[model samples]
Target: MDDPAAPRWPARATAGLCVVLLAWNTLVVPALPGRPASAVAANVAATGVLLAGARWSGLTWAELGLARRRLPAGARWGGACAALVLAAYGVALAVPALRPLLADARAGGLDGPAVAVRALVRVPLGTVLWEEVAFRGVLLAAACRLLPLRAAVALSCAVFGLWHVRPALGGLAANDLAGGPVATGAAVLLTVLWTAVAGLLFAWLRLRSGSLLAPVLLHLATNSLGVLAAAAATRGG
Candidate 1:
């Protein structure tokens, strides 16, 4: 529960920032001309901006799920989720055919050290940090105030799904999918759909653990290990 002194944000204003955050992540970031690696800097900055915006939107630390007391619970849940995902990735790598499915063209040409850096550093800081903090942290917290729990989750997750459209564009060839406008469109749509489903689970982590760190660590493991899985595929795993 929030402290009595915590300021309650107006539904309208909090909701407005939710919309802006969604659009900014989906529409604005992808359109900026730069290499994917360079986006890490921008996303790092964006994380701070989102937190500041959340506070200004009148969300308290507990509302944003960053309260220090909740960290232990969050870590347990997040760690368990991360372990499961890592095991699944291990299984996928063990299967010859499934390796192709794990291939990510973005990680295609990196050397050993480069891939290590990406999995250990880039994916965590660049992709997962801002995303969990944005969709699950600020947006979800703000949304819950204005809508039912399920509806608030749906709003955040749906947009979170669409947020991958641009990144998936570059990944189509990685899966060895057919090359055509229609095929690419379908692939992108499938990515969005699955990611939206994944978003629901991430939301559950945040709500269940009552801490943003839960989803953040889970997301970090997913994306970071994903980079390793992709590199393994590149090496004919």
Candidate 2:
């Protein structure tokens, strides 16, 4: 529970800023002409903003899961997350029905150069670093200060789901209801649901490990798998 004497406005302001930044990152950035690059830049900027906001809000590194000593543990959890995702991919390959979600039409043939860029720049700097900082670090930490622990987790998870709205919209556009509108809707819902669940898992890891490194690694692994899956599908793997 929040301290009885702590002023509430700063926390509320921090949370509001996070939601706005997420929407801008997901929705606005993608539409910009510079895109990908601009998006990455924006993410980098967001990280700085979150760190500054945390300080302004008087939040500690420990509260945001940034304790240096716990980084190794976070890395281990990240490895576990990667393994789980990879195992899921293995299962998807064996089950045709699961292929649609993993190997969607959007998985278009991999462009080696683009993949390299994403692996090096986009995934690391933008998706993994920026998001984990914003969601798991900043947002969750602020929420925790304002609400009960469980409620805070849920709120952060829900925000995480909304943050993926653009991607889900892209997925819908790519499929064009080839799977039927109902199926498409169901798939989108499932995707968002999964994102929220992952957010919850990441938040738990951050809370337990006391370091954002764990969620960052897990998040990186998760995104990396998408890149790998695209490459494999393109190559007939």
Candidate 3:
């Protein structure tokens, strides 16, 4: 017989919260009053809300892949991944044909000090941290409560891909690289697909190392180091 006193998983609440958060991240935050600062603030606020909701939904830190005891293992795994990303970026920059891939218009105008601040400070805090916390930590953990781990990862990663859709749409409009409606649509689809694949890898890292730190470090390296690499590549041209 089933235990009559056991707490239920609250599937409805989890689904509702995920929906709200998904909209907040993809829609509301983008239209916030101030850019960069407002966006960062909104995301931080969202992270707190996610944690609080997770707690309300009876999720433990361990369930969220953030157990204190797993810190060392997570760090080791994360650090290794980060180092590999740096090395790959270095190689990309070193190779003439691969160098163009790193040459981005985004970092082309950045001065040394600005690049330093953007890469070391802003990207780490504003982008990587919030994203990993939101996707792999809260969302994946919440999904696991109702579905199997594989299904949970799939759902969370799908949301992560959709999370990028707004940004991708805005970005394509701002840049001439993907001109025309069909081209823009294609670019957005590719962006979603690529980000979804990246999200799957991040979820794997989080689960494999038993800590959110693993994905955080890798994400930090990919975004922050990629910025530096882009600056260098742009300067090289």
Candidate 4:
């Protein structure tokens, strides 16, 4: 008989906590008097609560891939992969058919320098870390525990795509130009596909490296290159 007392994977608990926190943020926090401050506080509090839960569930920072000590070899490999992805993206942008799409993404008020700063600070350190923790470390890991590898990967990718649906719908709703809805929808569709592809890649990296650190590095590098490319394009324009 299977040992019923076997400890549940820490990832499962963390994913559940993330869902609850997301709900709380969406529902209760927004109703507070100081909405902005409440939102920030709620997020911070959620992080703290999740971290504590992780510890209690026998999860270390390493499990969540937050333990960054050695930085030479890993950084080198991650950088190379990022460069390759950027080159591919550059080729896509150079194609006349795709140029307009690239231009539209760039046309939003955020310029290259601003993008660079956001990638370096907000994206890599904040968004990437938090997102990886929630998606790869928590959700993917939990899925793997409960399902077969392929199923886990597919489910995780679906979840990741669904998470972005709201923003995509909002973009479609706000589209004003003649081809705005088409463009926005296309962009959103492409983004969803790209994120799914990325999820698979990141999953493979995590499994191969036996650490979340590798995937996190890969994600950071990808975001950094994207920011740099946007900046370069804006400057050229």
Candidate 5:
């Protein structure tokens, strides 16, 4: 029999820690010198802490829908849809009329092999995992518990968009091609809109798969293709 007076300490502690970590990474690290890596590390650490909390609370990875199980059908369909969206974006950017609007869509200048290495080693196994944990696993899940599904998804997307604002604005301001306040502002606005759409799509994938792994893989694939496309554009290949 369970103890009548036993407190739900583990759950409370886990929830509290998650909040603190999110606040620290979101509000504090952006102002630091080494921003991206520090923020990413903090996010990874927060995930680890949350996992520990889950263990203490008698929750398994499977209970959190974090188990690594293959969903071949979902993977195939999601991959196709993601590729289609990316191709549409690519085609739009390639059009002469849209070139001015997509000035920020330049490639990364990485070689083909380097792009492959970065996608496999740097993005999927690193950034995607850390980002998915922070955005989908922790933030979205917590928001869903407190708010309606739509509200949670919207708020999460807003937060995700805001998180990119600093870097996007800074890059635009620093770019020689992006001149004047009007141009910079337009670039930033476009970036924000794009990120919000991507955020919503990722969230939808998470919900549809009923597992974080699917979204993580999808995110990795999308980013990898983006890098490759960027490289190709830079080389005029």
Candidate 6:
């Protein structure tokens, strides 16, 4: 007979909480009034929720891949990821078909300096930290413990796809030259698919490096570069 008093993995509870948190961040928050502000609030809340849940489930920072000892290595890998993203954006700019994605539909008030400042602050603080911390750090770690590595990566990638649904849809609104609904839907699908692949890569980095810093840096660099690239492209770079 087995002793029923021993502590076991909280797989079911974690999964449920993950679903709720993901839904709130992706579905609910996007629809709320105040776009960028709501986005910031949603991300912060999601991080707090994930951290609280991790503690409740007896998970440590290391288990979450948040060990700070690997920061140096993570920074190096992050630089590589950023370089690759910029190279890809360079290609997109060269190709006319891809350039449409970088079209600047944003309101025109912010100039180069303002845009750079916003990207510097927003990318690392609001976009990168909470996302990499929650997705690659907390959710990926939790899924890995519950499932095989391959399965965990796939599931986490799927969850990551879910995370971008609102943003993918929102992109259509921010696009000045977006076509009809069908085209918008297809664009959203492609965005989700691409981000899913990116999520897999981030998860791989997190697992291989055994540090959340890798994903954090990669996430931050990619987003910051994106903001800068968009600004430049819109200004005819």
Per-model TM-score on C-alpha atoms: 0.88, 0.84, 0.92, 0.66, 0.67, 0.82
Runs with alpha carbons beyond 4 Å of true place in candidate 5? 1-46, 50-74, 82-114, 170-177
Cα lDDT, all candidates: 0.83, 0.76, 0.83, 0.59, 0.62, 0.73
lDDT of 4: 0.59
Give model 5's TM-score versus the native structure. 0.67
Per-residue C-alpha lDDT of model 1 across residues 1-237, encoded as one tens digit per residue: 234344445777766776776677677777767845667778888899889977866788998889999999999999999999999999999998788888876676788899988887788888888888888888888777766779889988988898888767757665566478988899899999999999999999999999888898889888888888988797784
Clash pairs (backbone) in predicted model 5: 107-230
Give the winner by TM-score.
3
Which parts of model 3 are misplaced by more than 4 Å? Answer: 1-8
Name the candidate, 1 or 3, with the larger TM-score value.
3
- As a TM-score, model 3 comes out at 0.92
Model 3, C-alpha of 155: deviation from truth (Å):
0.2
- Among residues 3 or more apart in sequence or in different chains, the pairs in candidate 4 whose N, CA or C atoms overlap within 3 Å are 112-231
Candidate 6, which segments miss by more than 4 Å at Cα?
1-8, 31-33, 86-101, 107-109
Q: Residue 170: error of model 1 in Å?
A: 1.8
Quote the lDDT for 225 in model 5.
64
Candidate 2 lDDT tens digits, 1-237: 224344444565757766686768576787777876888887898789879978777877777788788888888887787788888877876676666566645455547787777777789997888888888887877777777789888988988887877788776787565377787678778888999998999988887777899888778877877776765554553
lDDT of 6 by residue, 70-142 (tens): 7777777766877788798888878877766675655224687678766876566667878787778777667
lDDT of 5 by residue, 1-237 (tens): 012232333345435644565466456666757744555565566568766764565544433446566355447656776777587658855775644443333235455666677666656544677667766666665555455678767866776666666657666654455678887788878887888888898888777776666677678767766666556554442
State the lDDT at 40 in candidate 2. Answer: 87
Instruction: Name the weakest run of 10 consecutive residues (lDDT summed) in model 5.
Output: 1-10
Clashes of 2: 0
Which runs of model 1 end up more than 4 angstroms from their true locations? 1-15, 31-34, 173-178
Full-model lDDT, candidate 2: 0.76
